[model samples]
Target: MAAYEIKFRDARELAEALKALGADMRSLPFFDNRREIRSVYITDVDVRAANVIKQEMLSRGGDAAVHAHAVDCGVTESDVILFGTVKQISFLADKLETMPWWGFPDTVKVLREALASFSKKPATIDLPSGSSLAFGGRTLLMSIINLSDDSFHSESRTYGNVDVAVARAVEHAKDGADILDLGAESTRPGAARISESEEIGRIMPVIREIRKILPLMPISVDTTREKVAKTALEAGADIINDISGLTFEPGIARAVADHNAMLVIMHMRGTPETMGSMCIYSNLLKEINDFFDEKIRTAISSGVDRAKIILDPGVGFAKDYSQNLFLLRHLESFRIHSKPILIGASRKGSVGKATDSPDTAGRLEGTLAVSALCAWAGVDIIRVHDTKENKKAVMMAEAIRNADYA
Candidate 1:
């Protein structure tokens, strides 16, 4: 086991400080505002040395407690001390560097430096179903059930009827969908926005009916409005899947936090109405990363828990053909945030562009191909229209990932 101590003047500085310390910037856990403490991790071999280091800190006018493990380090124990302040922590790091037992001096040095320059509050989220999905591990599946008549993919769009949608939801559950994402509006580029009443009318009934049978399966409402999310949660929805990433609607984050519902914060530069025009990025990957960082911070400030938050790369949302391809190829870059990643590239315009399939239904193979790629890259979730096929692809990819370990 490894032990670590996180000491910060405040929680806001912890994230930036951790980044400076060379802690995997992307994998840092979300910190609650009230818990504004730093973590110092030490391995079992370093435990004795760590205790000596703690004693040194106490002697140097710093108060620290020993806990068995560090929260972010993924270690489980209670043998390490929780340091009280940053001033005492700063001197403690300096003292440890001079000690022989501080073998990983560089790691220690980076952590100390990170503490000095830390800023930015971490994001946190909570979900209705009582299960929290965080970053890391195999991708999570967000099965697509479009209720619009003119969805980019014909195979996905239902006739906005309750029977069809409920049957589809049951099928998706049988096909191994981790979550059923129900959407009434079509977000295809150039698609017109529907009225709020119409959108709710089309989706609420379907959600209500599905909850009757698959009551325990988490359901994510795909909308950018606070009303839609609020209504959905009231109708038994478990998560909010926002393609606008909570930027489109006012007070949406509060609704999510208020309901303790998980929120899928997707990355898209503009509204679906004009997103095609905003598909340019000087550095697509970096820009997406920065976008997520900002959104994650915003979500946290709004009271969403870090554990219940999921990230979507927004594959075809605002990206052009080439840029969309680039995002899919480099999806692994999102691991920096250490939150579960949900990639929605199923039978979108990008797949149609790649396969020259003018019809959305004709792109199922292409969608499955990308789904396989996402699974291979260790994505946490692959949002798709074809549940069975994508599930098969994920299982196959998992076999490959487990081959060496097995």
Candidate 2:
């Protein structure tokens, strides 16, 4: 007899494994409910709520981990980490809905929303051009086209020549890039902010030329200024990738809404000039989640449709080397927002640190490693410098990820 182990990512995969064992189709759902376990973190939860949650989960054949001081009320609030199968958690949420004290009912609502969001990924993202960006089946690649003279990757800088920028865009398109991101200003450490006119001068010509060349290819402008986003969208850009997460220039969200364009809200702590000094976090993942929650609310309040928004964890912006690594590993946690997650870990300092490659040019292998991991983690869009190579990595990783489906 052979005794070993099997692994599955979600209920569908679990069902497939059971079906291969000749299990009854109707019983698959029943097995699916109890086969997989999940963990969810909720911070600053009221101690009263924590106790009730613990009791309910235990009563349902699951458990929760609370602060050491939670049981005796030594702490006013406690951080709760819940552990349970899908069936147990769903049953717990249903029971919590009947309790009217300490916002248990509201907690249940949030829990249900999160559970639903994480389980079901968005299949397609509608774009402004009456087209859609498909997801779920495979990973998408966004090629970076830098128009700054002082870009970290010196070889990629095309500040003065529009022809060079256009050529790079064409090459990226031919290299299987699903989206092209053009950034005029450098956001590297200690990089000075350029005037609006200078920024526009660098990218406007390139945007117009790219629009003329690849009329159907989606163009994204990486900027934090309202006027720049408005100009780019008017001149043929379809998405705005804001590193500041709409905090730097809230008006940029309005520009996106008015143009009916997509927005990529990235989480960052400070400006490029000061972000290096702001790499402090008590709880990295929770802080980022809170940041996304607020920025998402801000974008929606400014009239941007929820479907047109994407979330990026800002891998290199304000994160230190270790934090960047941790962020990449837990990209799936961001799925709770129910937005397509975009990762741009291409040749960043973290990649250099990981591979012991001090030079940007030598970090291709590390970048490809990160790309494969992101693809397996179900990242929707991977912004990369080497489009063709990373496309291959993403495709191969995706094949392995869905190998069970075959």
Candidate 3:
């Protein structure tokens, strides 16, 4: 099965004409966005029929283009087509040479078609605030401000007095943080637990102060305790970043649901203290996928709106070095849930192992590298300790990724 992307001014009209010419109408739709318009996904049979249609469109004063390629068997069985208003079209066909003959044509066709479609309509993603999260758009940087002193990275610790914590939040906000993630308990491996009272006391004052300084900026409280979450929400936090997927604290889901707050559900193997030891997995990707599937269902059951939930693979939380890298490389897989994916690999232990940097402060370059990779993978949010560095990396990545579109 081969696919092709056809670009034209009147995508819907062209799509209708293609369907009239025996193309699959149901399979092709005009991809629309703020920038341009396009239609995509034409099969091999449709591409063959599209040649005549292309000529007819050109003769009728409608500008159109066709990109056709064969599918590859190794990576994908069927060909793909992307029809849009794209300026330049290219693909990694050489990488697909090892694919089976049955797959190569369709795979090639899909790329060509998608590239053609890109000319019609560039892809765009909308954020919760109705802002575009597309490539080249304004990148929102979420700074990691952990109130726990025992967090894995010593630099992430902000266990000072409320004044100090508030100062840190102000500094991050001043340094270009679009969102602040305030966490009370240390989610670091084998960290000592804090009482709910301690957690509330440690976080609430800081949250309240930060809100006073930056009321319009979004504030996220990273906790799994119902009481702490509710307290922070009442204190002016805008979102709940639960690493446990709301399983550790059953009432968190209900509280967040009831409050209509944005919720970030991260996938973790177990509690932080037990996570390092629970790194084993039969299929890492599938396990994470299944975990999110169930957690999403649970969130919805608890009265949370489906659109308010964001999925995080919880990189470096429980996985060993290799698994963390694998998750980062295949980060886009989580998009299957159709929700925004947030990645927090800032100054993580995995980077320590990869770059032989024992100190988190020395891992800024590595963290930026991972942030750039996440941006390339279309991750919606990147939680980082160095907001300035992450924001710069995101800007560069977005610029490079959307160079053609711009």
Q: lDDT (CA) for every model shown?
A: 0.74, 0.89, 0.70
Please give the lDDT score for candidate 3.
Answer: 0.70
Which prediction has more favorable TM-score, 2 or 3?
2
RMSD after CA superposition, every candidate: 14.4, 1.4, 11.6
Q: Write the per-residue lDDT of candidate 1 for residues 113-202, one digit (tens) a residue.
A: 445433322433335765444444455678888898988777777888789989999999898888899998888888889899988999
Structural similarity to truth (TM-score) of each candidate: 0.69, 0.97, 0.69
Candidate 1 residue spans exceeding 4 A from truth = 1-126, 130-137
- lDDT of candidate 2 over 1-406, digit per residue (tens): 8997777777778778777888888997788778778888877788989998999999988999998888999988888888998888889888988888887876887789767875755477667655578977678999999999999988788875899999999999999999999999998878999999999999899999887888888889999999999999898899999999998999999999998899999999889999999999999999999999999999999999988899999999888999999998888689888888899989989999989999999999999999999999888899999999999999899878777743
What are the per-model numbers of colliding residue pairs? 46, 0, 36
lDDT of prediction 1? 0.74
Predicted candidate 3 versus true structure: per-residue lDDT over 1-406, tens digit per residue: 8888644333544555566678766655423331253333333334433443344334433333454431211322222333333321232333333444545555555545445423322235333332333322344678888787787777768774787778888888888887788888888777767899998988888877877777666788899999888888888777899988877886898888767777899989778778889999977877887788789899899998887787889987789999999999877456556676789888888988899998887898999999998876667788999887788898898777655311
Q: Of models 1 and 2, which has the larger TM-score?
A: 2
lDDT for 189 in candidate 1 is 84
- For lDDT, candidate 1 versus 2, the one ahead is 2
| 1 versus 3: better lDDT goes to | 1
